[model samples]
Target: MNAREEILRRLGETPAEPAAYAAIPRPYLRRHHEGDAVELFAERAADYRAEVRRIPGADLPAVLGALRGHYVVPDGLPADWTAGADVVRDDPPVSIAALDALDGVITGCAVAIAETGTVVLDHGPGQGRRALTLVPDHHVVVVESARIAADVPEALERLSPDRPLTFISGPSATSDIELSRVEGVHGPRRLTIVITD
Candidate 1:
C-alpha cells in the first residue's frame, strides 16, 4: 500500500487513546493583577520593552514636535495634534512602502488588551494606514484609559468583523535554535505607548 493509504488504514484500526497534557508555566501571568487601567497599562508597556509616557491632551502637539523627522502617522489623532510638526499625510493608493521609509509612526488604538498586553489597531483617521505603523522603526501609540480592556475576550467583543484589525504584542521578536532571543526581525524595533489619564 502507498504510505498515505497505509497510514490511514492503521489510523482506522487503532482506537483513540486519552492523552495527558502538561500545564505550561506562565510567569507572566503571575505578574498581572487587577489594578487601575492607567497603572496597568504603564506596567504592561514596560514589561513589553516599550517606553511609557503620560501627557495631557493639550500637550500632544508639542510631543509631535519633539519627534520631528520621524514620519508621524496619527490615527484618529486630533487635528491639532500635528500642529507645527513635520508630519506626512497618507494619500490615496494606500501602500506601506512609503511608510517603510519613515522613521516612526504614531496612532491611537481601538483597544488595549491588558491580559495579553496587546494593542489593537483599526485603520481610522488620525491613525494613518496600517503600513505606517507596521513598516516603521518606531511605533508610538496613544491609549486612553477608557479604551483599555481587562482581557482579550473583552477587547474582542468591542471589535467588529467589518473593520481591519491589527493586534500587536510587544515589539517583534524571535528566538533561534540556540535559544537566543532577537528583536525587531519583523516589526517595529521600538514601541512607545502614551497612556492618557
Candidate 2:
C-alpha cells in the first residue's frame, strides 16, 4: 500500500476508547466545629481586617446616616436604611471614574458564611452590580442575621450556580513575594459589614 493508504489502514484497525474519570475522594470537613454562628462570623471577619458591626434593624438608619461624604445606594434597598447620607441612586449606572470619586457604595448581601467569614453577593435586590462594590474605596454591606450560615457548604447550598456570585472574604488584599501585604489592589480598601439582629 502507498504511505497514505498504509497510515489510513493502521488508523482504521485501532479505535480509540473513551477514558473513565475516577471519582475524587472527599474526606474534608463539610462544616466547622459547632459554635455561635454570629460570634464565629464576627471573629473571622475581624481576623481578615474587616470592620464588623452588630446593629438592631431599627437602629440601622441612624448608623447609616453617620457615614461621612457622598454615597450611592443600589436599587431595592429599604428607603429607611439610608436616612442621613447624601445618597444618589444608581439608576443609569454610575461611570467607573465617578464611582472612584464617590465616597462609597452600600448594598445588601445574599448570604454570609461564618466559618470562612465570606459574604456572597448575587447581584440581587439591594445588591447591585459587582462594580458598585469593587470600584469604590469603601464598601458598606448589610447582612441579616437569618442569612448567616455555619460554613462554606451551608452557604453554597443557599446560592444558585447560574447567578453571578461574588464571595468576599475581607477587604481586597494581596501579599507579595516578600510577604508584604497590600490592600485595595483589586477592590475596596475598606469593608464594613453591618449585621442586623
Q: Count the backbone clashes (under 3 Å) in each candidate.
A: 8, 0
Encode model 1's per-residue lDDT on 122-181: one tens digit a residue: 776756666677788888887877888877656776887588999887887789999898
> Which residue runs of candidate 1 sit more than 4 Å off their true CA positions?
1-34, 74-76, 93-97
Model 1 Cα displacement at 90 (Å)?
Answer: 0.6
Tens digit per residue, CA lDDT, model 2, 1-197: 89999998988875444332124445778787587898899889888899999999999999999999898888888878997777898988999899999999999999999988889999988999988999999999998989999998789879987899999989999999999999999999999999999
Residue 185 error for model 1, in Å? 1.6
Candidate 2, superposed: residue stretches over 4 Å from native: 1-30
Model 1 CA lDDT for position 139: 85
List the pairs of residues colliding in candidate 2: none
In the predicted model 1, the residue pairs found to clash are 74-126, 74-127, 75-126, 75-127, 76-125, 76-126, 76-127, 77-126
TM-score of 2: 0.84
Residue 5: error of model 1 in Å?
22
Q: Return the lDDT, model 2, position 25.
A: 48
Whole-model lDDT values for every prediction? 0.74, 0.89
